[model samples]
Target: MEAVPLEHILLLGAVLFSLGILAVISKRHAVVVLMGIELIFNAANLNLVAFSRYDPSLLQGQMFSLFVIVVAAAEAAVALAIVLRVYQYFKTANLNEIVSPENK
Candidate 1:
């Protein structure tokens, strides 16, 4: 068995990041946007792990990834709470609809 090349791992991470960006740009629902954000976070974690694999002793990359995970969890909670509040007031989760004539 052979180890996968670093380039290959990086490429996967890039693909994930790109998809995340596409989702964030194209999606309208708040939950979908949150999912896309999670995807981006995972891609970053993939990158951190890959780089840390090369420097096993320091583990800084892995540590930072953990910190990112913690931050992401907090972000998700806060963002979801905000989304719920918005939905409660506006009665719709569609971002476009939320910003329509009545708002203007």
Candidate 2:
């Protein structure tokens, strides 16, 4: 397979990162925020893989990317679980209405 240019991957990452940032800022839902966080993580992973492809001396970045994926998976699982719990307790998932006692 022909290798893609690093600059292309960087540009893609930049675009994804910007979109993720926008999503996080514009969305009021917790799930949407989580999706944005996932997008940001993927953007970072794309950059890592791009660097690993260009630098043949080490595979550390690629390995780190793998770890990041695993961690992201775990994070998503835990975050979803929390969201479910909150929904069950509150009967709503609106970010504005969900507040802790300390905040109230």
Candidate 3:
């Protein structure tokens, strides 16, 4: 019957975003980086939904969140395809290995 506080939701989102940033920075695998990017997108979506819940006049935040979800899905598909191609060409999924000039 009671609603959760907006600050809690925002804090959760911030934590997710920070974790995503850390993953992207610390991981060497392309797939892990993509997952981190997805985490960042989900964090933004969480913030959008939380704000939308507080404002009843319009559902723009929810609509935009839907759009973002769609875009993130498409982006994931394309990025995975690219990663697959890179793996096929380079025989590895490690970002550093793929980019190293010695490999070329």
Best by lDDT: 3
Error of 2 at 15 (Å): 0.9
Show pairs that collide, candidate 2: none
Writing each residue's lDDT as its tens digit, candidate 1 over 15-98 gives: 999999999999999889999999999999999999899988898999999999999999999999999999998899988778
lDDT, model 1? 0.93
lDDT tens string, model 2, 6-104? Answer: 889999999999999998999888899899999999999999988887688899889999999999999999999999999998787778889886886
lDDT of 3: 0.94
RMSD of each: 1.8, 1.6, 1.6
lDDT of 3 by residue, 1-104 (tens): 99999999999999999999999999999999999999999999999999998788999999999999999999999999999999888899998876656756
**lDDT for model 2:** 0.92
Error of 3 at 46 (Å): 0.4
Which pairs clash in the backbone of model 1? Answer: none
Candidates in order, TM-scores: namely 0.91, 0.90, 0.94
